[model samples]
Target: MEPYKYCDNRSHHEDSPSTKVEPTDCPKPVIIGLYGLPGSGKTARLAELKAELSNDEFAFYDGSAVIAAVTPGGLKALQNLTEEVKNNYRERAIAKIKQECYNTGKTAIVAGHFMFWPEDDENGWSVCTPGDLDTYTHILYLDVPAELIAKYRLNDNKRSRPNVSAPHLAKWQAFEKNELRHLCRHHDILFTLLSPPLASVSKVGFLIRDFRTHSEAYNKNAAERKMLEILAAGSGNVETVIVLDADKTLAQEDSGVLFWEHIRALSGAAEDSGPLKALFSSPLGYSYIAFRQATLLYEEVAENAEFEAYCQAVALKIRMHRDIVNLLHLVRGTRHVRAVVVTCGIRSVWEKVLEKEGLSSTVKVIGGGRLDDGLVVTPSVKAELANYLRIARNLYVFAFGDSPLDLEMLKAADQAVVVTGEEKTRSKSMEKKLAEEIGKNGFHPRQTVLPAFATPRMDTTRLPLVRLTDQNFLASVFARYKNLYVLHATDRPAAKLLMTPMRDASISGSALRKVHARAGFYLATELCTQIIGVEAYPVPHVQGHQADGYRLLHEEATLIVPLMRGGEPMAFGVNDAFPLAMFHHAKVPCDLQHEHLEDTATIILVDSVVNTGKSILQFVQHIRSLNATICIVVVAGVIHSQTISTSRIARALGRFDGLSFVALRLSDNQFTGRGTTDTGNRLFNSVHMA
Candidate 1:
């Protein structure tokens, strides 16, 4: 079997030594008491030593068993006893072990918790205080910091074990400060486990090796056999793995540079020099601000000048890097690999890149976007990738990144490959150096160089202006509807006087109904009714608490004219629930904005029922902008939530929010139950229409 494939039982026996007797002239049985704070990995070190020595011709018994035997009970009794009682128990246990070692001529490994001693000194080593020097041949102190031991204890999920708590942790800390000094001086071979000096795993391995070699029946190959056992046991059942980048490996630009550029762009300035120079002058310039500014600038200049074209060209240039394309392709092509592109870059740019390369079909791309604007990716790209890997068991993830920012992704991956671009680029070189540093510190994955590729310039200038206009239109729509509310108003004299009617009186209920029905009607009718005549206004409000930071709420308004009863309740409920709502008292006359009479504004016309829809049909006729962005007519009650074939209203609403209805109650007109003839009751009377 492969080294890693061996079961625990097999590995244990394979490493166990057959020889029984202690060698002549060998070192005396070293009853080394390995003492550290609970879960300073003391037990793990002991286990490693046992496995290593089992391969050597030695008989070793961990003093834990001796302590258990000497006590009234066993391990549980010693662990359950109070500190003072535990000390007495430990002393008695040590006495018994000393006698046994003297008689058996076999080495023993003792693990204990010792108090500090200030006066005792036998050798230059006085850092660790020893309780019973007569019993121990050498005291190997694994002196990890209290804080580190606490972390290991917490992560190990063994807090339920006896004496592993805050009080016990404090006791261990105090003992290390006062007792370790005396123990170090008396022991022949004292090994100190220093914190932050050696990697925890490496330190554990080292301690195990030291113990094996110092045993009476020392063997050179003991360490190797023990290491194999540990490795096999540790990695026996791993399934899925993910590898990710820490920096510009995924993003076209570094986060710092992106931020700097964003700030500069937000300040309304063109790059007189390079983005780097602008960023140097204004440190606050960042990619977010830059992208926002660029978007605004594109909107402004796209109409007449070459500026928009230039911006698009630059974006295309940055996004069309050959190395990125090849890497993405390789990941996509790999079996059992659901490739995901995660970056701190602007979503707009990456979306275009994915579309241009025809790779959008193969990979899911996540990038940065405005939070309030609703364009930002949700649940976070890193979190999404982690979720995907978790669901797809047996995955071997390979993450590639170039900077520290990609640490989360890299850590989440099963394996990581740091991609350092050309060394000629100082930025790339810096990334490589940082990756090297991280790798040295055992945080980074394997590194690889992504060779440069031939640049491909895609032209968007020749594409139809209609497409660009549509994009702008969609952007505007999303920005406007990031927050949606069904504003309600009644022309009841008091309410109308309190709030002026937003539109002219000529815009009637019928016109509003047409707008609502646009989603269900033909495309031409939708274009003519909702989008052309509906008016939008921005409402601002304040949000958040007093002590913390507050938010500036910018909400867009759409006039929702609901039919009485059912429609009115839903509209009012939605509007009343959300702040920053502006309900138009009545529909108003307005000139159509677009030549194509599409309903660009989102419209939801609500009603209680459509037994005949004679009222609804007439109402839809007055709508001018039929191509509205969203024309949804909602109701609190529907005869059929899924029966679109018979209900035109359901069919219409389905085109926008899909074929689904949010209703408080839904029932067919017919009654078949025992009390079917109670039609005179007011409550049940409305069931026919409903």
Candidate 2:
């Protein structure tokens, strides 16, 4: 079980520890709280992370040690203290950690607890300190199976333990995590769950290292110095650089616009408020020159609490362009593309936005007009910023933006792009200026028009908006994204090359279907086994506690959906391999009754052959409609490779999340299955009738 980062929206929401602090420009104190249930290996994980992060970059702390340092007599003295006294000591310990992290400028990873749950209790009470809740910015829970936790507790020689069942421990872990997630939400803490990794799982050390690296960009001088340090350490192989515009480019709405709108909404009752209202109505409000004035005035007039709340609210709502994010991810994946987000919006707000996306650690957010801002990014200065990345860093600059403000930066870039939104909802002024700039220059800078809606989860399209219903923006981007490694869109010819010999006119009846179906199942199961990997089984065994089950970690919930008739044979073979999987036979697209799909995590759609790939495409769409997060895999003995690569099926497959395909061979056959070549006819012994 690899450590999984929780999605931005949690099952629980609250406002507790984080409601008090203003979004400060001060070097954010990095305190990562390592939490878990008793016997859940919190100490072991802490030690491992500490050993891995042993450097000037990170500082390690033990909760008990902090308590001991402050309270004197440590655990011995604390034992005599009342629960209230103990909690006070815990708060003091957290304060000490905060000071150390702030002073040393090192990330602190502390081992702590959320609550103490005893056996036989239905609900455990939260013992988390207010200081702990407020100070720690990130919380990672060591999520282990209840049976394993029970086993570890029983095996422990550390202390006398109460008797508990696997179910009891499981319930306890669930309660703790639920309560902790709610607490983190209220406190504005980033909460994630990490399962104990199998031997094959990759290390989560990079997540920590990346997070540590991201926190430094808050300070401009420090961030600049670090960038220089990277250059000094890195090879001079970075030839291309991407310069990004913040507001309407990286994010959907302009941050400034969103902030002002939020303020107006907040002051709805006091709409007659003059000072803020006057700044907006005055000529200064419309110009970039007045940003500093407005912000400075805002600091004086707006309640610190209200302003900070709005910042948080706006930051959370700052919808990142998925296409752009995918582009960044593609760049990051290569590990060489130089990309920086240069914004004229509040640097802090953009920083918060980037941080929420888990990119602040790696991507630099440069801009500001606020009090603590060291470098401001505006239209006039954007070119200078591009020049620095191009000239000083000696990297080819590629600029992406959405407005006239980005004209200078775009002109300065080696390869410039104007990222536009659909005409209906996108900033028309920005789009108009971008079109004018392109016409004025007559250069080949790309204009990537994204989705019309602001909602990030909208299934509109992951690619740029194509305006026309026919063109797929995602596919178009792939065609242009030369760095992208895409499959040679036509697999049918290749599938034919491999499968033609296996399927001849002479090869008819169940023998042909069985051979093809078995081959499909073989390839499908192999892929499934590799991807979803096995987890530890606590069942009694003679050899060892672990087994190479050759099954998905989520084997029970893995659903095998077979297109009826021709698909059943291959699905049966797949079923033989993944015996724990639930089998659902579908005769048509509508036959995919999704009522039983709520608990399903993975759907394996099986067919003996895919000529046009229509059925497979339909099933994929139906499954995605039921559960957007479900992993869909298509298995076929032979798919017309050309159809998979060139058709809408290929494009559709690319858009869905976690969707995959496996085929024994790619076929070049364009013939419809009517006679001996018909897969369903052969399987049904209808070849004689043909």
Candidate 3:
């Protein structure tokens, strides 16, 4: 028979040194303490856990037995010792258990106590040692009802126990629980308070399994995979995904607060303190374990169907802010932009709210309510999702959040909106954090007040204002991501004809330069015409009749910025295509002045070759800083195949508006030309100098 798989009459002999298995590699060993008052059924739950878990995967120990084994004179001698001596013995015992767990590669479930309260004592003596705090990864406290604990103590026939009043027991349990929670949070341990006696064992079983398999890396991967699937299923050509936080972000009211109020009213609680309020108010804050505890609270309150009804009731009362509703409606019609609600609040509530607003089919929600939902959107998860969407899936992420919880996601986003509401209804706690993020951290976010009259967060200069409901603003945002064009030899055979003269080794100096110049002219006349568009003007026909002639849009106002020496030829080539366009020489991004962009309708940045696109990115960003609305075109003789997808300029193409790229051809060659082979050296006939 396998060891530790079955509970026996012996007091914790299965985990002894003689039965220790060979160490195997695993994630950090999880040592969980089953803690409670003496009569709170910790022993019973430990036994059940031992029976349920695999012997190969778990080890079980009784705190007293472990202490006895490590003590000099065993259990009787330890009992006779002073409190300080017993604490030393307790620490040694836990250290031994931890060492055994390390050697065996098994999770350890230990039945332990927080304090031993005498009925007449002013305070209970806490028995938890520093070793226990450092070694234990999780602590599951059995918060059984005080009446049940008193009854269990009275009925136990195995040993004599103290007779404590129910009210006294309740007070004692409350103090222990509060102190333990604080210690767990400080020690970086996951803690959950399982209540009502009957549910403790079952909850622990699930939690133990989760502890063994789940990790921060695992959760992040799962969320990324789920989001990828959602993105794939929803839109075929999605360029931007707007990740919106539910609760106070989308609506003026917080669903978590509202749901707790409804639950409180139903339970006839004197205060608005539901289990959730108490759970969050604890030292756990918004940690992953705290969110899990919140889920368990919801699960404990009602059956699955009843829970759905409660969420629906909360959803029915929610009215999504008009600005957000209008923006989402616009996004729904925009084929390239997809919206998803990523929330830490109840998923069902947000889903129901979207359904009521007829947006359920358009916007998806990623969150958790019950344990079975399998995914919980914590703050870290939200941040990871935003980053994954931007990096992994290569989608532009526009995030909207209203609290400190959303800070990470906002920071990860390409564009962030801090949704502010009317003064009284706004998030008061978020202000200080936001201020710190702006003042200390290099976080720059735009604030969007739902009602235009509402007080803005910080000064308008610090967190600039954006009108999400404005049609022109939305159009400009959509314009940023919708245009990315790559012309390759396979797509356009005529492009190969123009590339032949430029690639020939027989060409050098002015001959090679003119070939590139012609290629640039051909690309401008063919590709630039289609992208930058054309405007018709009156012209004299050859037959002495008035006719219409076409020129590049706002041709006279266009500024062609040729990157120093190598790009001058192509700049002149582009100039030949549009004689009315002006030319500017730029060696670096700063070479182009703000005054040059004032009347510029289009700034075409011409380059001979874009190997890494670093130079192109710098120029485009500089141009955007000067003029946000200028139509920018990047023309290159040949762009490396990888540079079209993974380069800095490729990423920036989706982040800036009115930006387009036109290249003569794409080459898979990763070579960066040097000396004679260099485009710049050959363009200037300076290869011999190398």
Which candidate should be chosen as best, given lDDT against the real structure?
3
* Candidate 1 lDDT, 372-410, residue by residue in tens: 122222123453454345433323344656554454556
Overall local distance difference test of candidate 1:
0.40
Candidate 3 lDDT (Cα, whole model)? 0.79
Query: What number of clashing residue pairs does each candidate have, in the order they appear?
Result: 69, 15, 0
Better of 1 and 3 by TM-score: 3
- Per-residue lDDT for 580 in model 3? 95
Q: Roughly what TM-score does model 1 have, to 2 decimal places? A: 0.24
Q: Candidate 3's residue-wise lDDT over 1-690, tens digit each?
A: 111111111123333222222255655578989898998887888889888888899899999889899887899998897765666678778888888888787889999887777989766666777777878888888888999999999999987898999999998888877787677767768776785422655666876887777666766677777787788886458888889999889988888888989988887888854666666677778888777767656765666688889999999999998888878887777777889999999999999999998888889999887766776779999998998888777777789999999999998886678999889988789888887776333356678998778889888666767788655457545654433566544257777777877787667889888887887788789888888889999999999999999999999999998998778888889999999998989886657766788878898999988887767765765566456789988888888877667653476565677777788887788778888888888888899996
lDDT (0-100) at residue 40 of candidate 2? 80
RMSD of every prediction: 27.2, 30.3, 8.3
TM-score-sorted candidate list, best first: 3, 2, 1
Tell me, by TM-score, which candidate is best: 3
Residue pairs in clash, model 3: none
